[model samples]
Target chain A: MIKPELLVTPTSVENVEEVIDAGADAVMIGEERYGLRLAGEFDRTAVHEAVKLAHERGVKVYVAMNALFHNDTLPELPDYLAFLDKIGADAVVFGDPAVLMNAKQYAPKVELHWNTETTATNWYTANYWGRKGSARAVLARELNMDSVIEIKENAEVAIEVQVHGMTCMFQSKRTLVGNYMEFQGKDLGVEGRSKDRTLVLHDPERDVKYPIWEDWNGTHIMSPKDMCIIDELDELIDAEIDSFKIDGVLKDGAYIRDMTGLYRQAIDQYAAKPEEYIEEKEAWRDRALALQPDNRELDTGFFFKETVY
Target chain B: MRTEVKETAAADKRVITKKPELLAPAGNLEKLKIAVHYGADAVFIGGRDFGLRSNADNFSIQEMEEAVEFADRYGAEIYVTTNIFAHNENMEGLDVYLREIEAAGVRGIIVADPMIIETCKRVAPTLEVHLSTQQSLSNWQAVQFWKDEGLDRVVLAREVGMNEMLEMKRNVDIEIETFIHGAMCISYSGRCTLSNHMTARDSNRGGCCQSCRWDYFLYEDREDANAESGNALFAEEDAPFAMSPKDLNLVQSIPKLVDAGIDSLKVEGRMKSIHYVATVVSVYRKVIDAYCADPDNFTIDPEWLKELEKCANRPTAPAFFENTPGYEEQMFRNHKQKTPFDFSGLVLDYDADTGMVTLQQRNHFRPGDTVEFFGPEIERFSMTVGTIWDDEGNEIDAARHPLQVVTFKTDQPVYVHNMMRKEL
Candidate 1:
């Protein structure tokens, strides 16, 4: 049998059960106001239910409290963390250090998964976080496979790598798209921003076209092409990466099932016939490619190339 | 919903007595000394290795020691920036480098990476650690996180607005610094990879060609078609400064910043000329000192504004401190942002014998043209150029050649790197 190891952000209650059903070893949940995913809809009841469902199925549930907290919100986090701990979350994934600092003080039970929002690129950072009570490190999306292997070799903290989905090219706290819309006199909630009217920009010098949008969190200028590395699951497993992450909290259940199922199948097949992985790699790539949304372009980003200055 | 941050209780009563530090950027040793003379309380600079701003004439061990000595005379501090996110390979020589910086008497090390922060704590525990804005700590909770991590100071992110800053001061028990002036990053604090994807240069590591400021065209590649080709149908299109934020100018926001109890107000131009450093620092220095002297009477001055306007080359906006800037704040994309004055020359040496100044031409200047000469401590002073001549005493109508040292007749004598500019 294939060694089971796949993690996905279940986004909502609508997909939480389905995500677990589709062979995910773990599922991440987030509240709209708390995590980096501003479009998230989970509240206290929803989050409690998600953790219960995942735990019942013998699946680990990690709740994301990954958004950077301002002074005002920092005070509110302790109660939320206590709630997560009360609901029995297996891990709490967060990017901000303040959450960890406060969690250590007020709500100490929730296992902290430090996600530095692409800042933890090296082995030393992994080792550093491991020392600081981080149960896992969701490595930055920018790192190549070589770096990931190096991190795994050096770090005692378990590593989680995003194996599939949309990667942010530019993330800014200033609401660029929101400000631009307000300038046009459109009230955000009243106007109901759609993908049809999404602002598409291309830096002619770089010739890179990207989609820019805003939520409560701020503007996210995303790469035009989404990333999919399910075809390379064997490589991650060989490198001893603990978790293969699917980055789709913003996507729907159909997306959730399709993406999660593809990675599950890929991992299973690769494990069943370790020597046959190379021979069957093309078929795996073809199957994974078919599962992707036809409208969106796809690429194997930053995986093949090292980020050298 | 991310609601607008509310103004907190006025912290004026608690903050007005003790003066906040006026921090300036020193790209070179000369600029470091000039900045302190013009009233910079501290200077942040790059080292020969590991520091960001690879293009700057970063300090060697000797220059850093000399710089520390110079700043000590004025009771100013020197901070070395090793803000680059280090990889495993990059960790070599890091311990040696930290020890070297500490031995050179650097007051602090501004860092973003936890590994580097750990290294600093391990090797140079004596040196203070200031979190670089590159880490993008917009929230006070994040500031507290750095504090717990043993960092002494936290540089607030540019995305942090005025109200948020006040709240940070009220809540976080750490020295808070904010960038008051200079180029704002299009990306969050400094996390970007546009340069990396476009060119081979990784922005996080330092070789930022400022790909955001490149001439661009607004091309709309609609989703309905062009799936394969990625061709765009045109609108009224032009792309210039598409990603360039108008340079931040908070000179007028001195009172609010003072009230917020911000520990330091940083000026952000490391690759700028000594004249730019002198002009910008002195103006901020005057503004900060005026506020400290008479808190209630401190009003934004038109003269100070005029002096600042002549130095900066880009269009200025009160960036995120007030609110998010609109479309008008963006400089033109097809060309560079227009300035009222161009950098005309640099004052080299003054000759009492000839009553003339030897100047190096940066742009171009002619005889009989009025030019403004300003230094670190001095305000704008205009002098009419009588005659211009090259090295061999041959009089030339115009000093056109770049980096050509020429003698020009002047009534007022000036020091080295004192900028002279002609009004356009």
Candidate 2:
């Protein structure tokens, strides 16, 4: 059976049912994309609510706590993990080893997914997380298709790839703006417009002068790009991948509908006529391409191998 | 009464002591002029290449030269942005871009890439290199990491709250520049892939079509697709909040920002209008000067605060400063309508004795519309549609055309520099 997973931000819950209904096997929930921590803790109530609803429909729910763990906040992980366990999260996604270990220790029953934030580009990191008992891993966004195939071939655990979404401009969760705004006495996580705030430097080449009040988490590093892998599903599935994931928790339902529908059709076409599906694959590619975000260029995301450039 | 005044005076103590550099954004030459004229201590702009904002009206080489000269004439610093996340293809432009920017007498180059930093150091050794926020320098180790790489100043990440910044400052020696106002990103510093994954435009490479503004939903069962192929948006009750908060405004908290030991106070708009540049710069300039003039006697004028509200803004809140519980301050539905007032013209002459305010109209203004006068302070008062007299005292229901100088008598004194606006 072709099981498709959509990586969703909690903000994209509006389209979650639609994604699942469109034949997505599961949904991954993450923090708001803007980096503002609206809730003090992971909105467990929302998670439980989504889980109950999804389970009723035969879909699984995954919670993404994929941000880099601060050293100062490490002490709180056990409690947070325990809370995640208490909330009956089907699985947890994280970056830091400490957080992963803590989640494994405190919430042994809850499956853990290694987030791409850890930069798991090879089998070694994937194997390490698998050995540490991770059930799945959301591989790095930079990994090409070949690297994904290789990692899947060697990985001991399930492998997840970001089929779509913005790629972070930075290496990991290192943020000068987050630290700077905090230093200025502005709590970056607060949910309101404050007199004390952070500024995103758009056009950093120009003298920084414009004051953008929105997205105070620092300008978003990238925009959303739809992942159209409908044609590549057979190739990915042949690589022994555990899950085909869609990235974006804040995207619209129409995006969810069009993307999931095309993938579902491609998977069904591949299953029915393996050789004949090549032409169907081209059709799926066209369908995926048609869903592109505002006419942006498309790439296979190093899906073939490690990016050389 | 004396005791009450004393208490009020005591409450007005300075929040911060350091004189933070006011950094502004310049999309083009005109914005650069407005920023400098208003009060920017330094301005940052994108060059024609290697900057993230490819869409902005980036400066040409000659414009950069002119902008540097213009800023220098006013004693303001100019920083060129070379912060795009470069692949090999983009590296070729770095050497020439750096050399030319440095040659133009630019003060610094804000960058995020390590290779670019190395290139800038070799090509323009004298130019200061500030670490861009895209680098995401959250901890002291990372701060020192960039410093060791020869970063002269570091713009810290937005996800860090003030307490963490202080901790980082205690551990690092690098100059700290923090954003005091502007748009906030939904992703952590520059670590988002939401855009590039959905659109092939890599936001790090700087073409971002904000996908975050779109609405989202959480589906319970995948079958909602069969229910209604067209109507499928669903959201869980506790999902992340939609829409980014309006840009940060720290005008009233300038003293506290200075106290935070921030080396520079950066403003965030690049695609904004000239009026935005002038208004924001002048307000911050006045607030900064007021603090510097006499810390003991400084108080933000209520009138100045009202004037600040006239600029395009959502509801204002002091983000995270007081550590209040509730997200109300950051949540804005949307702007109600375009600002009700359109800037009409400036007052050319005013006579306090006759209470006559004379001006050239940028747009036709009808009688009975409330007019807002903006200068050192913003004052709004209603006007009755009395007989309007032209420059020659011709009675008319409205000032019919552009540049038509009209005179009206009002009780308040109108300054020559005052800008007038009429409600739409």
Candidate 3:
């Protein structure tokens, strides 16, 4: 009886067959990484193609337009919003208030999700976004388990959290890497020698180097660690969260198959024999951790207590 | 050549002069010395109170005095940060802190609040005020607004790119200082509430708990929901900490920065270690000096780059120098690998004639482990430990005691000023 949602990266899509084979309830498709540089024109044809493919198999497709848009770029919103509506995108992820306001007028039928970049730290912001128009609010990456619980308890809208993929090292949307890039006369979106731009922080005590690369858009660096929450299924479910979102734009089909397969098994096993599910949970945790990047440290985050600065 | 590319290749290249000042961070007096020694034209520091980093071993009055003297000796400027967002209670010690800073002969005070700026103007007029990035100066309007308020300098918001910077530079007359390197805030400028909302600690006021770095899960269904619908689900994913990219490094881009006519290149990490100050300042100094000496011949030394790599870092990217990409572009897929080396020991004394280097064993080191000697202006040597003598001069296979003075012979002469460390 447990409802499960998978936030599939459109980039994770191999074809309509792969999505149908995975049997996911819904799919979130947009740019691999969301931002002004990468959030180019929302591919209407792709959206139409995805929606047609997903609908043919009874799966819903959500379009991601989740990047902070400046006031200067406000005039271009209506067209993008209308495009989503015309294409019949199941939903659209948005971070900017202006975009939301415009989306309300232009594409009222589409479900709206508050992107994580809005940095909705508390229930007030979450509730506010929900009230304003967002059907679901993507919680900030900084939220601990307790805070997430508090948000779920307090939020009026559905709460979606990033379940997997590379976590961001900076705040969503607002970053200086793009500003730095614009200064250097290089377009971040284009793939070229622009990849060589490197940000390094010196850790003198450890005597080691930390390097942060600019994304294709040049706004912010991608996080080194991927979020894997397969282990704490019981704890998360107990918190009454609404949806589980996975972030894998560049991942292969096996990733989706393996991850979805494991989660499906865990949810089923947990429901079948609650006590016996502990072993299944451990096995799933091992699998999830094995899929993560090498030598990466993992933490329970804010779920236990507030992390140190 | 491509058809479109060949046509516009003859665009005019404008020449620029008036190089920006180099502003460095000093965590303490030792770091201050290293920064100045390594070629920081101006250095910024925080005091124990009224500064953002409460955890930093900030400057005491005596240390401040020494720092001022050191800057004066090196013909450099020292700017003290009084930039913390002031609450009602924080205001009680403000007058005293300001008076003490003025007495310390600081060149300027970096502040964010308008009330503090006004107060500084009234009380400590001699101390120039540089607006902190917390004020969020992104446009000519904001720059003009701050300049109208009598500010001498403004630290532009980190969200601004170089194109906007150049545009603002063209419009605003006030001195512009931007963060060239170090830890970046995930939030805009410094206006983050993730810490305050998640915990009681306020990030805007600078007491951040850094709740962003924790792992997260994407749940599909409500935990208490009925299983029949197949719509509700719980999925878990581990999220990274702080949502902030690693600090900025523009060492290789010094020439471009100089050409931009920026007023200052600011290095972040006021809470960093002395070694960080030395390593960063030394490398930057070499790069800047090389460029100043001959712009065309300027080349980043391979050794300096290696030394920088020796410090903890993920993959490096030029932050917002060219364009603004999103989180995916900025995210590092790999965490910095902890060096296999441990700072096992330091040389306490050296007898040049005897060819013996006396050292205190800080950590356990095997005889086979490779050791690196860190010395000023010298290439770091990779040497293997050959023979070891314990503190009592007894022949020993290894030294493992804390503060255990050990001696070993080197192929070449080593100095007491240099420290020896080995990789595990």
Q: Candidate 1: where is the Cα deviation over 4 Å?
A: A1-4, A38-40, A181-199, A202-208, B1-17, B212-223, B227-241, B331-335, B351-354, B376-379, B413-417
Ranking by TM-score: 1, 2, 3
Q: Is the docking of candidate 1 incorrect, acceptable, medium or high quality?
A: acceptable
lDDT tens per residue, model 2, B351-384: 8788888887767776666676655543545454
What are the per-residue Cα lDDT tens digits for candidate 1 across A106-223? Answer: 6688799988655777888887877878888888777788887898888888888887877766666665554444544557676443333445556554455666666656666666
lDDT of 3 at B281: 71
Please give the TM-score for the first chain of candidate 2.
Answer: 0.76
DockQ of 1: 0.45
- Per-residue lDDT of model 3, residues A1-309, tens digit only: 455465555353454346457555677776533332221223657667778778887787777665544333456678877987887878888764455667788998999987744245556556656766789878766567776777788778988876655444433343444443333444657522222433332223332222334443333433423556767766666666767766553345566656655665665666577677776666777877766534333444334445432
TM-scores vs. true structure, each candidate:
0.90, 0.58, 0.55
- C-alpha RMSD (angstroms) for model 1: 4.5
Individual DockQ of the candidates?
Answer: 0.45, 0.06, 0.04
